[model samples]
Target: MTSSNGLSSLGPEGASAAARALSLPAESYGNDERLEAMWAMKAYNHAEVYFNLISSVDPKFLKLTKMDDEIYTKFRETFRDLDIKVLDPELLKSAEAKERWRPFCNCYEGLVEDFNFGTLLRLDCREDYTQDNSIFATRIQFFAVEIARNREGLNDAVFSAKSSKS
Candidate 1:
């Protein structure tokens, strides 16, 4: 029953419900500061390795996953209209985009290890993974788009630039 007091007035059931609610995450539901830091570190390392790879070798030959061909094909089929060469911020971060991406992400659930783990994606395939140019994505999403870029000859410019410098 409603009363002047809080949960105590409502009795044990209300108190227990309140206790459960209080136990939920303070910030975002799944967020843990320490775990977030770890994910950031992992994303940074992967970005570095990917940068080094595209810088030295032709991105066409650089495969991030064992099923590179399949990933590329499915990505193209799923997102036929998406311009993978230029990773649009709206496409990456919008609520609409998340809904659109959910089924595509789910397809790789068993095929790719940690497919949904957070990763740093370069907004522009032609540029380095600078802070302003990067956004967080899933591992499979990153692989799919990057593989598409490489196959489409979008990332060849990075190799060309590096070669010119050498």
Candidate 2:
């Protein structure tokens, strides 16, 4: 698929957004050059798929990944004070948060496919996948934070109002 920006999208080419891929249109970027967020499109795809999943299914029935328990547990252990519903930008951007997140994210390196692939994560569980509320993060970080949000019942807000209206 192609984005409106004229650059061909690296997503939706018969591969799950979670798949491991290191290729990009070399013509567009030259051999080694990369976009600041190489996986933004994929991240957007992932966020949409994930949001739809949570909207349709209750958090208790949601299983984000094979390592859901591990990711959620470790995330909670590492970030005891995290406000999952609306994440602080500093938590994902500051140098210090990265320092604290490195070990935790690396733990799933081999166990989860494409664990380090760049992806977009929504800063607020209640928000849609708008550019303003999204941030770049590794797949594992996305899993960890999103899993925690689902399990904590924070993401129920996604479909709560709509469901009630219906």
Candidate 3:
């Protein structure tokens, strides 16, 4: 986590490099405080895990770094495109994962009108802070979470089926 300089965890260049690696505009992502938080939580290791996934796919520098350089590269590109302000790998992955699962959620809502305890377990919950009114936002947030959950379920089902077939 600590950069080569040893003054800060990510020195000025290292932070900027990390930001650039995440593809944020200058001064956009991973401020010192957020980096500090990541260090505190040992999120750096998770970032490394993600980096490994990317490395397996790309392998641009297979012998140079232990980390997955490719996934880090994708993260950079995505963060830049999304204009994300925060610098947490899990949050970024969650957002990315949400996109993949959104469609399954949309389909589930129209087909299911009732919920039981098991039904509730299949919902994806999200907080909506951007609504014009609190009531609408809360309602929409709940709906969105449920849809997200359904999408996730669909994804799991598909993945399981594929694995079984293989």
Candidate 4:
């Protein structure tokens, strides 16, 4: 599945279909290691906070769950695998990252605007951000929805193509 650009065929057909269904093949779908790093830090922070809250005097106030932490961790790893380099550590430590990655901010919006699921999911996760923690849950939500849609769409596309061919 080598692309015309000579990149390995973006992995496998199933993954390709998932990418297409997510509308991520055109952009925001490739190697993005830096973004991955930032996301990892943010997710770790989010999980840590959630765990502490769920176990402590403020558990009622935080109301976080192990499931929430798991999901965040999964998304963090997935984004890490992207190998994106949008936000360098030094750059992130700068004032610009602070302003740009603020909670409820759409800095990563550019990364997932191609698809409805991704966009919607981004919005959903923004609700969890704080001034101190800036990992965008929306990105994870968007990825999950996009991936699900991709799988479903791939099955449909293949089934239809096969039927038409027969």
Candidate 5:
């Protein structure tokens, strides 16, 4: 899809088109090659915060983590009941699908309101990236999924191995 500035929603190329449309200085746009790297860093920072929160084992977070687990387990059924596409990366590429998923993804309502949905990133969690495993999810989805993983002991092996090394 194209933005109002006539740029394809394909990251750097889109940003370049926006910069040109707005008559922005070349310096202002920085290195286009670095945009994805910067986004990855942002995602990493968010994950770090979530991991720290889970490490603390805060009661509210623990409760939410349990809820996230249940939600993910019943994801397909939830989508069916809501009449939306079941968790597919392709489905999340459109604004309409994002809106459809918004109600179910309201765990972080404040961040959701403030975030740019169009810039949502895809994260592939599998050993190999595939249509079924790669997820085009909002920032909140990453947090929810990771939190659930931590709470359900899925991340224990990694942490335990790390601690063993130390």
Candidate 6:
């Protein structure tokens, strides 16, 4: 079957053949664990970009506007609807889990329709790469929480914490 992007869906045999052509190990391509790892890595990279963008701004100039707060509230409700504990960093690995979260943001606009994936945040959690870490979150989720933090003077605490450790 052809997808909306006009890319034909590859069945198992075709996928395996494609993987072979690309010189990928059979265990890596189309493997759930491997796919999850790739998703996590991609999310992490995206989050890092967002963080750098936020950090580049002067904290005093980063106050959230009314619209930012509204976005944040909308995100909170989205999480609530999904039965995901708000602010608990957990990677939404399944298509179903991601589908429930992505509509709130234009993260995938101009991208393929089947491109569904997102991250979560656990700021209180340690910096390790474990699921508890907050290093990965959906683009909009990151913006919502971080914008709220900036407006509420929470980033100051984070900055202080980082400076103290240095």
The regions of model 3 sitting more than 4 angstroms off are 1-8, 24-100, 104-166
Best TM-score goes to which candidate? Answer: 1
Instruction: Tell me the tens digit of each residue's lDDT in model 1 across 42-74.
Output: 577778778888888988888788999888888
Rank by TM-score (best first): 1, 2, 6, 5, 4, 3
Candidate 1 or 3, higher TM-score? 1
- True-structure RMSD for candidate 2: 4.9
Q: Runs in model 4 with CA error above 4 Å?
A: 1-29, 58-166
Q: Tell me the TM-score of model 5.
A: 0.39
lDDT of 3: 0.32
Which 10 consecutive positions of candidate 6 have the poorest summed lDDT? Answer: 1-10
Query: Candidate 6 clash total?
Result: 1
State TM-scores per candidate.
0.79, 0.78, 0.17, 0.23, 0.39, 0.43
Candidate 1's C-alpha runs over 4 A off are: 1-30
Count: clashes, candidate 2? 0
Clash totals for all candidate models? 0, 0, 8, 9, 0, 1
* Number of the top-ranking candidate, with lDDT as the measure: 1
For model 5, the superposed segments whose C-alpha errors exceed 4 Å read: 1-37, 45-100, 111-136
Best-to-worst lDDT order: 1, 2, 6, 5, 4, 3
lDDT by candidate, in order shown: 0.81, 0.75, 0.32, 0.35, 0.45, 0.49
Regarding TM-score, does 3 or 5 come out ahead?
Answer: 5
Give the CA lDDT, 0 to 100, for residue 14 in model 3. Answer: 72
Better of 4 and 6 by TM-score: 6
lDDT of 1 at 10: 43
lDDT of 6: 0.49
Which pairs of residues collide in candidate 4?
1-9, 32-83, 32-84, 33-83, 33-84, 33-85, 34-84, 34-85, 122-138
